[model samples]
Target chain A: MSTRLLTKYATPDESGQAILKNAMEKLDLSARAYDRILKVSRTIADLEECENIEAHHVAEAVQYRSLDRSGWAG
Target chain B: MLVKTFGAAVTGIDAITITIEVNVTRGIRFFLVGLPDNAVKESQQRIESVFKETGHKWPGKRIVVNMAPADTRKEGSAYDLPIAVGVLAADEQITSSRISDFMMMGELSLDGSIHPIKGALPIALQAKADGFKGFIVPKANAREAAVVKGLNVYGVESFREVVDFLTGRKEIEPVEVDTDAEFLKEQARSEFDFADVKGQDSVKRALEIAAAGGHNVIMIGPPGSGKSMLAKRLPTILPPLTLDEALETTKIHSVAGKLNGHISLLTRRPFRSPHHSVSDVALVGGGSYPQPGEISLAHNGVLFLDELPEFKRSVLEVMRQPLEDRTISISRARFTIDYPASFMMVASMNPCPCGYYNHPEKACVCSPGVVQKYLSRISGPLLDRIDIHIEVVPVPFDKLAAQKPAETSNTVRERVIKARAVQSERFKK
Candidate 1:
């Protein structure tokens, strides 16, 4: 998806935003990883019948980015 | 006198209708024109033999057959039926007015028998769209072409039968199919089930998410971790194929000449696993003729690449664009064709060269940078396209020996279908 569509559909609420910001800093996620995480979180929330993405959904989506994490094999 | 008939040329997954125009002139030769390839050009010899065997005399006067939209290269022996039919009608041998009302496609055998041709489904679809009253295909291709409703599909066994049916001398039944009923009946039969596997619930969970969101995934595991087994069963847990998807998948398989003679439509999702030692042409599809490759064959299904690092670097390099656009376009000197390749990619790799990197019990024998070197075979750009990465370890002996019954793939599939329903609703504009 384009960056505009990603921001429009997958952007989470305030507290979810805080969780994403913290995860971005701690995990050193790239912008690509960030967009993917948002999309996955949106799916996770949809799975749970949640209209908005929750913090738990974002956390679960972050776990899926294992390959993007540097030094993962070590 | 001039007579017209119709045939179809399958280009990529769709078919283009070719109008065969035949006229008799004063000379004593036959001419086949309109950029026909060698296979199509060779149909004349078979036609001559078929006419003799069927007790019909070959036309001696000069005859010219022109396939309209001549820029499109007609590249198969399937044109034999149409050309032969048009000639007979033009020469006043078969005085049937029904010649112009249908599309005829088949390879004529020397014994006057009609041979099955590839891409019958796409050709029939094109004929129906163009308002043809009927489609005449070889008996072996009848069921495949009959899946398209609102068109009479006649399956003829030999050239004599075609002549008799067209001349109103013999009655031929048009094939009929209840595509919806057949599709529903076949939806419940899956070859593999998640319940058959002993353990690896975590990996199954990851695959479940991948199915629901249509995400690509990779698994890193040691040997004997059941990666291939899990990959094979992924299609079982995904939602059942809708009728439209079944048709789409069937068209790709039909153009690739992969469908069996009797199977009208594909009931189950396809799972294609090409070995790592495949060429770029075989993997992503490009050759002198530009046939659909493994990716196109794997359309609307899972393409499992086992031992991902073992594949040639150039092969993986060629797949990046198709992975992004979900369609592979091949540009030749004369024409460019696009094949749909929207498959969910499932790839597996060992953790390192020795298959023991970060293993709980195994000691790594490979020295320092060797592990990194082995991992570098799969380029980073390809990895970026994959959204889910999950690690798997061999099931412990206790887990393997446990008597507990695992959850069936059907049960997981129910939830996946529900999730997909939500996704479609959310995305519906």
Candidate 2:
């Protein structure tokens, strides 16, 4: 569920890429995992009951992958 | 038909009561109101699954969950258990009249276990403040919420457990916390004593002054010097948090999801050591929905930055305000969140890039100009905020090999506690 949230909103420029990478390695996830991020974005859209995914929702979904965007100490 | 339950909404470190109103009607959809975030809004699916898994029929009718008063924002999954239970009771799936006096909270897993949630301290405190009779949180968070007085705190591991307790089929005992006892245990002895550190009496003296005045300090030294180790021991000497201070500290940590849940109140001062590569936003904290950062977590405690110059310039710059103001104000478009960050800053950096700039035993590899450039990475203004500056030199071979029993952490802590006591007494007046 959390993965889908990451794909739709999180950008590779932010930490989301690293978080996605780590989850992929640790949990045997695939490109299909991108669907999880999309799902997360979808859920975020649903939260607002908006007809489409907003820029802010996509931005937030990406931000949760903190380590990817900024090379933070894990 | 609709039913209402009470939960707590945490802002910064403070928690206020939020009314969760569930309405089931003859309609086609699920609606969650009251400005819920993604986590809160998606809770319907999780809660619905839990209901089905627990042998209760899912509400086929249109369900609307309105978190009131209409304008306030609600975040996190902590509201899941309460909302789920409220729906069940209201839908007549679980026949219970006893849920009225007891507040419940937890994140529902598909398989029926109740997952842990954050800010138990603030939520429990809010429950007590609102005159709620009791609270039921996840088992892991029971100890934390139990710290609040005048509230019966119960911990449940599964949706069935909560249902059983609420429906009077089974009874769940309330968890108890002894704040006084926890304080006494914290006061007992420290593991790292000042006596163990050798040949840096000057640094120790500087630390003592910092402790007395609650001032920030910086230690410049070569590699293998005890700067990092000394910073770790600072909390041992720091005065224990006052009851009010402890609660305040706990709230920030709770909101940040840093509290492990064993300890409710933070009697001991926090010592946060974020690595050098931290971001400006992560260091000071910022997002669409702002959360507490390393500085906020270090409230009323110490923030130790080792390899200080290695941190990004922008990241360190963000700390300048909080360093001076003793608090950080995160301005989001919707709301501004302020977190207390009145902590003693203890930073350590090598005199030069190679870390052998001032070593007597080893030759300095970096040229003279290089040393200045490396030091220049830390801005003059940031350095100015630090009240004490000292150099830590390597221990002499004789001192390192000496058989003398160094003074223990207990000895240093006594003096620190005494100095802190003096300061507290002064602040009281």
Candidate 3:
């Protein structure tokens, strides 16, 4: 997705913002990962028929990014 | 005498019509010009042999056959038919005023039989766009050429048939196809479905989301955890290819010579799983002639890289440009060609070298340093292109033994389609 589409379609809500902010603090994600999380949350919200990105949708997408890779499988 | 016939040279996924102009003057030798490669120049021998074998009087005059638009290098033997016919018509052996009404492409055999040529669909499309009266391709490529409407398509078996058709000596039926109906006939059919799997609801959900959003995915798990199996079934739940998407995909396949013997239109989303040993050129589309590679073959579909880390890092690196731009551009010193490669990349890798890093039952035998080494084979930049990460766990024996069928891909596809509808509506601005 282009940056224009990313900002237009996947901007998070206030509560969703805090959830992402918390995850960023905890996980030390790269700056590039911030945009992907929003895109995925937008998809999750779309799947659930939500017009706006919700806290839980952002939370779910965040969890996918934290899945075990160099560590133990979650 | 001068004769003009038409053929095409496939550059990238499209074709440019090459005018085969044959001019016969007072001399004995043949001269082929207009930047033709060795294969095209060698068509003189094949054309001569076909004339001799079929007992057609050869025009012993100086035959200067030129493929016009002098800079474009004509590469293949497919130009054989047009060149042969141009020579024959110039000598008035096949005297027809309507010869230029059709675009022709086929390779001639020693005994004058016709062989299939590549890019028949694109050539057919270009012919229709150029308002040609017809397209004459080999019998084997008829179905593909027939996919295009508003043009006469004649599939011929031998050079004799072409001559007869052009000279009005015989009538050949133009191929008729209801491509829309043909595409819809098998649109919903899938060779593999989600219901075939016994368990793993979470993994299925991730794949569903990925399909709905056209997002890339990565599967990390131990061996025998159903990663490859799940990756193979991703296309089943993908929304079926639209008519335009199918045509685009089929054109790429056609120009690559991969669809000569396959169906004219691809009804389902393509699921291509090239082996990990694929080279940089084969993975991303580059060569001397520059054929569409596996990624372009998987356009408007899925490209599953099974054992992702097993692929050479350089091979993986070449995909980064197409992943971002949705198209790959190959540039030589003289020219450049771009092939469309918009595809969902679904890749898989074991969590560790021993393939059991976090198995539910089997203990991982690889050391910590070894596991890190295995993970680093896939670079971070490439991994960033993947949108979703799924950790596949092997289903237990009881779950595998359950006789109840899981949710079918058709059912999942409904929701996926619904989700995509919402996306399109949201983006309708």
Candidate 4:
């Protein structure tokens, strides 16, 4: 949840682990909760009418769920 | 017998007179039929209790209350006193022919006191337009509504007083408001006195030009560089509200239930600074029933979005069209509502994520890429809409401590008012 972790580990191009991390904290979800982030990412993909959840879409969705405010902020 | 009277209810900013039909039937039940919100539905209990306290028999028969044009959702408890008065007057318990000449509105307490209702100015204007002799609203709202001339505006304290007045048992004087005084007060407080701000004279001059031209502005500054303080003061230096502009601004606040019952028109321009966390629905305004959002609330005034980059991109992006068109039209499957949002935008943001990236006296820890990315959070198209952009530097310690009677708001405001008058004359042409 630290800003440093977002800056260091999370890339704007990849989904990384922030979504799963958010689901764990917000939903007290287990590692299995990665699927929920995937689902949400899929929904956003559908909104854009994309054939699949592209790397950027998933990454954006994950960024949206970031517990570290810095990662999601512009 | 069914007795009918009409008073206005707001659907967004537009007010439509509702037909209040009270029928005292020959049964032992009471029914209120309308698409009333919980607040409106609860009026029955309030009305009946007031009846008991006033020593009037709650019509033992099946009493039916119908708010006609019922398809339009009726919210708020303002209808309670109207319906109560309608029932009492209909039953001939309180007799007065004057009821037909006036529009009555207020929320009734169980003990029969009238509580203030929102949108008094709009409702009063609507009543006047309908050619009603006068309007009877809560005493608190009377002054607000009194801003409307050519109409007798009565402010009543208790339901008993309203009942007594309407029945010719007592007389209530109509309220009067000093709109000129309100206007003069507005001319006195210039938004952010440029004199008080010691440094950043360039930024202040830019703001002055923006205020003069009615242009959107953005300020990029490090934390505690007086960006917020400057934004807050913009309204003071801007042009005063014309009577028409004041009425329009007052209507939006009324619909949002933001009017705090000053009982006079808002002569000052509005200044709305919504937090970044505000939802799209709350910012642009939409519901099962449409209400004004922040953009509409900021009409005829300034809408300051501080920490602009921190706001959700989607939420900020949605404002693009409204920013260009000066109106927001929210379309649902069933209905579409358009709210006026012709407001001057003044948004502020930090140079980087840490808010100290470009501080003159501080070290820059954030990389250049981080600064660029933070600025990119606010889309390019949105940035294009803003006419003025300036960077604010921190004031020196000496300037902050030295107060040799900085230029007061009144002096700066006079210049702004003059510029506004120029705009008004040009627009009229």
Q: Which candidate is the best by TM-score?
A: 3
Ten contiguous residues minimizing lDDT sum, candidate 3 chain B: B259-268
Model 2: fraction of native contacts: 0.00
Worst 10 residues of 4 chain B by lDDT: B420-429
Candidate 1's displacement at residue B418, Å, is 1.5
Q: Write the per-residue lDDT of candidate 1 for residues B1-429, one digit (tens) a residue.
A: 899999998888899999999998788988888999999888889998988998888888999999999888999899999999998888888799889899999999999899898899999999999999999999999999899989899999999999999999998999998898889998899779999888898898889888988888999989888999999999999888888989999998888888887789998888999999999999999888899999999989999999999999999999989988999999999888999999999999998888988778888788758887887888888887887888988898999999999999999898888888987876685
DockQ of 2: 0.01
Q: Rank the candidates by TM-score, best first.
A: 3, 1, 2, 4
Local accuracy of candidate 2 as per-residue lDDT tens digits, A8-28: 333343344455555556544
What's the TM-score of every candidate structure? 0.96, 0.81, 0.97, 0.79
User: What is the per-residue lDDT of model 4 for residues A1-74, given as tens digits with 9 covering 90 to 100?
Assistant: 12343233222233334444544565343332244345444434433444444665555444332222333223
DockQ of 3: 0.54
True contacts kept of 1: 0.35
Clashes of each: 0, 18, 0, 10
Backbone clash total, candidate 4: 10
What are the lDDT scores of the predictions, listed in order?
0.89, 0.75, 0.89, 0.74
lDDT of 2 by residue, B207-314 (tens): 765665566777888988899988888887676678888888888888888878677777788889998878888888778778899998999899999999999998
DockQ, Cα level, model 4:
0.01
lDDT, residue B355, model 4:
84
Off by over 4 Å in 4: A1-74, B190-192, B396-429
